[model samples]
Target: MPTLKELAKRPERLTPGHRLCAGCGAPIAVRLILAAADKPVVAANATGCLEVSTTIFPYTAWNIPWIHSAFENAAATIAGVESMYRAKRRRGEIDEEIYFVAFGGDGGTYDIGLQALSGALERGHRFLYVCYNNEAYMNTGIQRSSATPLGAWTTTSPVGRVLPGKTQWRKNLTEIVAAHGIPYVAQSVASNWRDLVNKAEKAFHTDGPSFINVLASCNRGWRHEPSETLKVMQLAVECCIWPLYEVENGVYRLTYKPKEKKPVEEWLRVQGRFRHLLAPENRHLVEAFQRYVDEEWEKLLKRCGEA
Candidate 1:
C-alpha cells in the first residue's frame, strides 16, 4: 500500500473552475474516487451540489464521461445505463468493459433516492454508488436530511426553546445497504485521504453493487472557517462520531480506530451548527450523544471481532 502522500499524487479527474464552495467536500471526494478508479468510467450524478456546481451550462468539471440525472433517480439511471451496456455486450455491439459510478448527496440517497438505491442493490448491479453525505440538503439551503446527526442545527431543525437542532439520530444508510447482502459496503471520510482512496479502489473492483458513504463537511452550512474542513472531519472520526469501516461479503471490519475516543464536544464546538449545544446544561446532552456513539461503536466492534 502506498503512503497517503504518494496516493494523493494521482491526477485528479475532477478539475478546476468548478463552482463548489471553498472547503466543499463533494468535489474533493470526487477527486479521490476518480483517482482510484484509474480507468475510464461513466458516472451518473444526481441533482445536488455536485451536479449544479460541476455543470453550469456549457462548462463542466468532470474529466470522465458523466451525466446529470434527476435528484431521486441517479441510482436507477445508472442501473439503466449499466443494463444498456450489458445488452450491447451480449450482441457484440461493444466489447469493452466500463465501470459505472453513481454519485448523490445525503438528501438524494437517504431520503428521496432510497427506493431507487434499494432496487439497484437488490438487483445486484455491477456498479459503485457513492453518497457524499454532508448530513443535510446543503446545496439548496441548510435543511435537514435523514443522514443529519442528532442535535445538529439546520434550517429545518433550528435550535429553539423546545427543540435542540435535529431531534432524531442519523439514519444508518450504510447498514441499510449492507442488509441487501452486497459484496462490499464501506464508510470513509475525506479527512482521511488514504482510506478514502483505498475504499474507492476496493469498491471499483468489486463485482456487485458496492456502496460508500463518505463524510463531506460543508463549510458554509456548518459555519466554519473554510480552512477547518479537514480538521472538522478529523475531529468527527476521533470523537467516534464517524467510524471508518468496510464490510466485504457481509463481514464487517474496522479500517481505522481512534487511539482514544475523544470527546464529542471537541467535534461539535468547531461548527456553528453545534455552538448552541455548548451551553453549560446542554453540554450534558452532547455527552449523552457521545454515549450513544460509544454504544454504536461497541456494536461495530463485535462485528469487527474486537469484542
Candidate 2:
C-alpha cells in the first residue's frame, strides 16, 4: 500500500488553475476523491461549485469521462449512467471495471436534490455520492442552505436585531444516508487527506451505493482569511464542532479524536458568521451548543464502545 505522501503524489485528476476562490475547499475535496477513485471512472456533477468552475461549456478540467447535469439531478443522472454501464457490461458492450460517481454540493444533496439521492440509494445504484458541503449555496452567492449550521450568518440569514444568522441546526446527512442502509456512509474533512481518501477507497470497494459528506471550507463565503482555511477546519474537528467519523454497515466510529477537546469558542471565534455569539446571551447559547456536541459525541462514543 502507498503511504499518505505517495497517495498525494498520484496523478492530478483535477488539474490546477480552475475558477475556485482562493482557499476554496471544494477542489481540495475533489482532489482527494478523484485520487481515491479507480481508473475508468465516469463522474456526473451537479450544477454547483465543482460543475460551474471546472466546466465552462467550452473548457473542462476533468481528464476522465465526465458530465455536468442540472443542479437537482446529479444522483438520478449518475444512477442512469451506472444502470447503462451495467446493462452494457451484461451484453459485453463495455468492460466491467469502470466505476460511476456523482458530485454535488450540500444544497444539491440535502435540499433541492434529496429525493433523487434517496431514489438512487433505494435502488442500490453502484456509485458514490459525494457532498462537498461548504455549508451554503456558495456558487449562488453564499445564500443560506439547509446544511448551514445553527447561528451562522449567510447573506440570506444575516445577523440582525431579530435574527442571529441561520437559526436551525445543520441537517444530519450522515444519519440520513446511514438510514438508507447503503453499506457505507462517512464524513471527513478536506484537511484530513488520508481519512478522506481512505473513506473514498472503502466506498468504491463497496458493492452498493456510498455517501461521503466532506466538510469543505468556504473562505470567502465564511468571511475568513484564505490562509486560515485549513486551520479553521482543523479547529472545528478538534473543538468538537464537527466531529470526523464513519458509519459503515450500521456501525459508527469517530475517526479524529482530540487529545484534550478544546472549547467551541475556539472554532466559532475564527468565522465572521458566528460574530453575533460574542454577546452574553448568544455566548450562553454557544456554550449550550458545546453541550450539544458533547452529548452527540458521547452517544457516538457509546456506539463505538468508547463511552
Candidate 3:
C-alpha cells in the first residue's frame, strides 16, 4: 500500500470543483481508486451522481481519459474500450500500458446494469468495475434500489404505518459478482482509506475482471450531517453491517474486523433513513435487522475460514 504522503505526490485524476454534495462519499472513493493506479487510466462512468456532478456539459472534473455512459452499461462501455486497447497494442499501434476503470452508483450497478456487468465479467475483460453504493438511487431523487438496505427510508420505500421502509433486504452484489468467478472482488468503505486504496491497487493489478462494492454514504439521502459521513461509515463497519473483505482466486479474506463487534443499533441510530427502526413500536424491526447482519457476518466468516 502506498503511504499517504506518496499518494499525495501523485497527480490528481479527478480534480476538484464539481457538483457532488458536501458529504457525498462517491468522489472520495473515486479519488482514492484513481490515485492507486500506477499506470494511466481510462474511466467509463455510468450516468449517476458521479457522472452528472463531475462532468456537467463543457466542464469536467476528470483529468484523465473519461467517458460518460448511460444509466446502465458502464461495464460494457469499458469492456469495448479495453478490447480496442488490446487490439491496438497487439498491432503495435500503442506501446504504453493503460488501466481501465468503470464507476457506477448502486442504481446503475445493482439494478439497471447488472446484465452488462455480468456479461463483461463473463467475457474476462481486464478492467476494474467499482460500485459506489450509497444504498439507493441517490442521483435520481433517493429512490430505492436493489442495493438499499432493509428498513431504510427512500422516496420509493417510505416509512409508513403499513410498511417500515424497504420490505426486502438488499441484493448481495459483491457475492453475485464473485459467483462469476472473477479474479478479484471486494467490499470497502471510503472512511477506511488504507483498505480501500490497497484493494484498488490489487484490483488494478488483477489479470481479469475485478469488482469492488464501496459503501459510500449519502448525507442528503441518508439524512446525516455532511461532516458525519466518515463517522457513519465507520459505525457501519464496526457494527458488521458492512464488513470489509476481499475475494481473490476463490479465496475469501476478511480485510478488517472490529476489535469488539458493536451492535447494529450503533450504525442505525446515526442515519435518519434508519431512524424509524429505532422507534419503540418498531423495536422488532431493529432486532430483525440485527439478526440479518449477524447472519451475514457469520456466513462471511465461514467463507473466509475464520468461523
Q: Against the hidden reference, what TM-scores do the models get?
A: 0.97, 0.96, 0.99
Candidate 1 lDDT over 1-307, as tens digits, reads 4466766787667889999999998888888888787657899999999999988988988787898769999999999999999999999999987899999999999999999999999999999999999999998899999998888899999999999899889988999899999999999998888899899999999988999999999998888999999999889999888999999998998999899989888888899999888998687688788889989989999999978
The ten-residue window of minimal lDDT in model 1 covers 1-10
How many residue-pair clashes does candidate 3 contain? 0
- Report, for every candidate in turn, its global Cα lDDT versus the true structure: 0.91, 0.87, 0.95
Tell me the tens digit of each residue's lDDT in model 2 across 200-248: 9888888999999988999878879999999988888898777788888
Runs in model 2 deviating more than 4 A are: none
Task: Identify the candidate with maximal TM-score.
Answer: 3
Best-fitting candidate, scored by lDDT: 3
Candidate 1, residue 126: the lDDT equals 94
